[model samples]
Target: MLSRRSVAVATMFLGIIYLAFISLGIPDSLLGSAWPVIRPDMGASFGFAGILSMVVAGGTIVSSLVSGSLVQRLGTGKITLISCCLTAGALLGFSMAPSIFWLVLLAIPLGLGGGAIDAALNHYVAENYKAHHMNWLHCFWGVGATLGPIIMSFYMVKHNSWRDGYTAVSMIQFTLAIVLLVTLPLWKRIAVSREHERLDSMIPQDQVGPELKQPAISSKANVLQIKGVKQTLIAFLFYCGVESTVGLWGTSYLVGARNMTAETAAGWISLYYGGITMGRLITGFITLKINNRVLIRCGQIIAIAGGGMLLLPLPQLFLVGLILIGLGLAPIYPGLLHETPTRFGRDNSAKLMGYQMAVAYTGTTFLPPLFGLLAAQTTIHAFPFIVIAFIILMMMSAEKVNHILNNQTKSTGINC
Candidate 1:
């Protein structure tokens, strides 16, 4: 059993990690929620937002691809602190940017910081925490996501100031970064305690030192050759495609298709993220009763139904559809993350987490821009159909992964 002091240290460290995640999420929705006003202010075309988004996503893809190595060298605490500072700087730069060019450049660091934080914390939580804790950790992320738009909406409604929104969030990031620095020693203490505890038998025997670094299982290429890895990566791709596309374009769709004011649209978008927050909170409890696969399948079905509702002409359906979609999407990402150590081995989970997140960011990078082109050629009405396509692809890929893992289990009498 852990000593009371060890338990206290672990709990404190986990709390710090959770706060870092909030910092990770604050900037995510800022651009999307403020884009309508921003477009008019900068005299940019509607589709230009996608270009900006693509730049950010590209940076994230690069960062995520390399995060495994970076984390091994620097440790999660240092990585997280450095990433937060980068994002804080980038966000502050965004608030002062005079043109779209400057905004595009600033987005690079923002994405890099975000991707590192995401990969590091996700791998950490998946390895150390239970299924419910994973769900709740992501629920806090939902809190930040939900707050982003609300913050933007408040500024837009009251002050007509998108810059102020970005500035406020940047301040929040900076403050969290400071908190992370002060508590850096706690991460080390907890890691050492847990390493000594060997809390789970599944923890790789190869882990060394308080940092918990281990040599790679094999080349990335070899890891990809594992059964179900490709399917899992594909599922991640389309899942993030659906999510990023929604956040990047949902406000535009609200204004262009459904004829809502920017402020109002921002508020409604917050409700969408609010659904995500509440859904994940509930799903944390639900995971005690249901396994990850069932929750994932159920979420996909509900999301598909929500996409159908989005295709309807009635404005009344828009909010309902958005909420449904948000709730539906809540479980899948965290569920998949929590499943990684079991699906692969704990030894491989860190490396796989990086690749999985890289592919996920690849989806974020390309899919929204593709839809932007589609919307530019035709109408924003294509948004729902595009979302439906991504969700269906994601669902099929996830099911295939399940089948592959199931077959492996049956054939070998071992969990894949």
Candidate 2:
């Protein structure tokens, strides 16, 4: 059992972590909404959006690759607090930026901050927190993600200034940074608790069960040697691609294929995001009873069913497909991460999680653009078909992960 102080510290730390996740998301959707206003004002073409996005993705990929070593050195709290500062600073730059050159330059720090904090917190929580909190944490990010666009929309219509929206959200991040700094002691307490557990674990071999953990996996090279790592990475990659492609292109598909008005398509896409948020909310509770693998597989099966609806060419059924797709996509991200500690040892999962994140963001960066080109060259009608192809790839990769893990577990004679 945890001491009273330890439990209290854990509670406070968990709350801070959730708030950090929300901050992580604030800038993610902000640019998308504000782009309409930001573009013309800076005398930039629409193609500049892709250039800026790639810059951010490049920064994220670099940061995520190095997150394991950084976390080992500085710890999650320091890294997260500093990351918040970086992003908040970038947002301020966005507010004051006089040209597209400044905006593009600021995106580097924005991506670096976002990636570091994301990988650090994910591995920390996956090792330390419960299944429900993991799922709920992502839901909180959805809250920030949703809030970003809303803030932009408000400033656009009310004040006729998108810059003000960036300023306002920057204040929120600054506030969160202060809270993190004040609660820095909580991370120290968590560190102490972890050290004590490690010492206790060193007490005897029999008491702690099998010595299955490989500490050398703390490095990226060794972590890749862990069973199912590559397959899991592939699964995450395709999963993120499927989710992004669908979410980004679903509005267009609705417009071109279903003949819906732009306004109606926008509303339904909003509902699709709502479906994701709501589904994660529900998933947090359901995970209490169901197995993790079962939850993941069930989520994919349901998503496949939703994808089937899209392929049917039925009118008004596309809305149902959108919601179903959102609900089905909900649990997979967190659920996959939740299984990491068990599939690989706790120490190894830390590195693997970072790599998983890097690969996932890579998918977010590249695959959607590929589909965009394909859709442009052929027809927008191919959007759903492309999404479904990615969905199938994700499923097959997941199956490979399961197969590898199951065989490894059997060979070791341990339950996973």
Candidate 3:
């Protein structure tokens, strides 16, 4: 059993990872705030800006896959440390880059580091921590996401340069990285013993002789079955699409379509994230009381309703629509994350998270660019329609997944 102190330390480690994710968002949020100014400064066309956004999304997809493999090889702790360092370096590079090309190149490391930290930390917490901890851990991410834009907006309004804003965020990230590095040894000592024992138990005892022999069960073979893994992966892929599309594009829609100022748009964006924060806290309280599949499906319906509201002609409904979307999305990611360990076993959670994250990042990569392209060609008023389509797809995919899980539960007598 994990000791209380060990669990607390692990949760803190996950919190550090959330800080890394927040650091990733600082660049994104700052870009949203600074784009109009920076675009003119850089002499770039709107098409170029759209392509640049795609480039960052593309890097995220690639890095998510690469980091997943790295985590599988090096363990989460080492990968997280390396990711944080790379992320900080990437931010510094962004601060100093002389050209758009250089900025795009810097995005590579930023994406890699951010993707790795997200996958590794998510897997670690979902597998090892209690369910409530998973919700709370992601809530920290919501806090960071909310703060990043507000901080950038403040600096922008103060007549400070974008470089200063970027640099400030980088310094904060570096501080978190340092804190994580200092605490890493303690986490490793607590975790490694359990990992080794699990590894040892996987070996064939007959080949190692009587001393190595232990209880005979088919747990390993059963765990290796890939059918359910494929189903879950499909569910996660669309879920990623729904989640990232809303998050990355919603601010732009508000700015471009609704004629809100950048500051106002960002403020409204904060409400979306704020709703997520509150929703996750509520999710933490209710998950033990409610069935997860039911909660997830209900969330999708709420998200669809939110998306539909965005499509309506009423201007007053926009904020309410976004809040509904946030509440709907809040439970899905963490719920899926929390379910992984039970489905695949704790030992496989890291690699599974890596794979799932890779798939999810593909959605993140594909959707934003598509939205950007569409927004570039047409009015941003069309944005809500795109979101609506994704939400409906999420609902359908989740239903399939729930059905699959239910059938599996019936067949195997397992709760997953």
Candidate 4:
């Protein structure tokens, strides 16, 4: 039996996992900050930078699939351990790479580890933790993401070297890896409980003993086969596109097109991420009363408004717009994830999340490169329009999804 204290300890361990991988965002945040330093050091072109991000994104998509399989084979606890080590190794490699090609090569492990950590942790949290816990779990991700750039920016200002900043962040990840390893025993206990629950759920309820009434057989089937899975996946994909496109490209647009200073651009970027953090925290509370579909639709509108603000000529209003955008996007990811197991059943939650993440990472991988290519050709100002287009598509898809889910609820007489 897993004690409440044990579960709390496991939650802390998972929070450390979020902290570990969330630090990965530091590299990206540093890219803009260190552009001048790194470009001269590595002789990188804009196309090369785009390719590097593309490589990471591509690797993440593939690795998400691989990690999903690993989780199935090794279990979430073991997979998380492997992922932590891989992430540590990748960051260490990235910190020391002498050339851009070497850095790009290192991106493979980084993606694998990052994607694995994300999928496994998300699965664990969704399975072991309650619904409110899911919100706070993702909130930690937001916190780590927000801290990444700040840490990088602080180190860059102090050391005047991007390498040092990366190396420091690498150390932090290494420390997290050690912490995760130390907590492995407790995780194993939780895993056993989860598996037992799974076994119990698979047996017929009438045949089940009183102790096994609450079974854990969360089905691992693809969302398409499940009644509500298809609609959830569709909403999830569009949400991923909108969230990633904006997160990756917004800073570039501010600096390159609007000609803002590095400091101002960084502050704006902070606002964008901070808004996400705030939204997640608030949504964690508000979700108790509100339907997720309603929350998601409201988020879509807010994202559209934020994108619109950036598209306009008012530079002064950009920060206000970004906050709205962040707030809007904040709920979509966690909402969709929380709804997944509920819609599809818990047996296959990890696999479903893996596929969901793979497709979503695919969006993150491709769309950013497309935005970069567009910026290279026309102007960074055009990037917001791309975001707008995606947001519109996401909203339409979400509306359709809401309709489908509602009809399914009526047909099956399921409350969700």
Lowest lDDT sum, 10 consecutive residues, model 2, at 208-217
Off by over 4 Å in 2: 191-220
Better of 2 and 3 by TM-score: 2
TM-score to native of every candidate shown: 0.83, 0.92, 0.80, 0.82
Q: Per-residue lDDT for 200 in model 1? A: 44
Provide the overall lDDT of each model, using Cα atoms, as 2-decimal numbers: 0.85, 0.84, 0.72, 0.72
Where is model 1 more than 4 Å wrong at Cα? 33-48, 96-101, 149-165, 195-221, 248-269, 309-319, 375-384, 414-416
- Tens digit per residue, CA lDDT, model 4, 96-129: 8899989889878877777887877787777765
- lDDT at 68, model 3: 48
lDDT of 3 at 234: 69
TM-score of predicted structure 1? 0.83
The true-versus-predicted C-alpha distance at residue 86 of model 1, in Å, is 1.2
Query: For model 2, how does the per-residue alpha-carbon lDDT over 1-416 read when each residue is reduced to its tens digit?
Result: 56798788778788889989888887899988898889999999988988998899988988888887788788888888888899899999999999999999999998998998899899888877777888999999999999899998998899999999999999999999999899877876786786676567564323433323212223335788876788888999999998888878888888988898999998988888888889988999998887667888888988887887887767667679888888998999998888787677776666677788899999999898899899899999887778778888888888888887667655654533
Lowest-lDDT window of 10 residues in candidate 4? 209-218
Instruction: Report the lDDT of model 2 for residue 140.
Output: 94
lDDT of 1 by residue, 180-251 (tens): 899888766776666667654445533433222222233344578877889999999999899889987999
Total clashes in model 4, counting residue pairs 3 or more apart in sequence or in different chains: 7
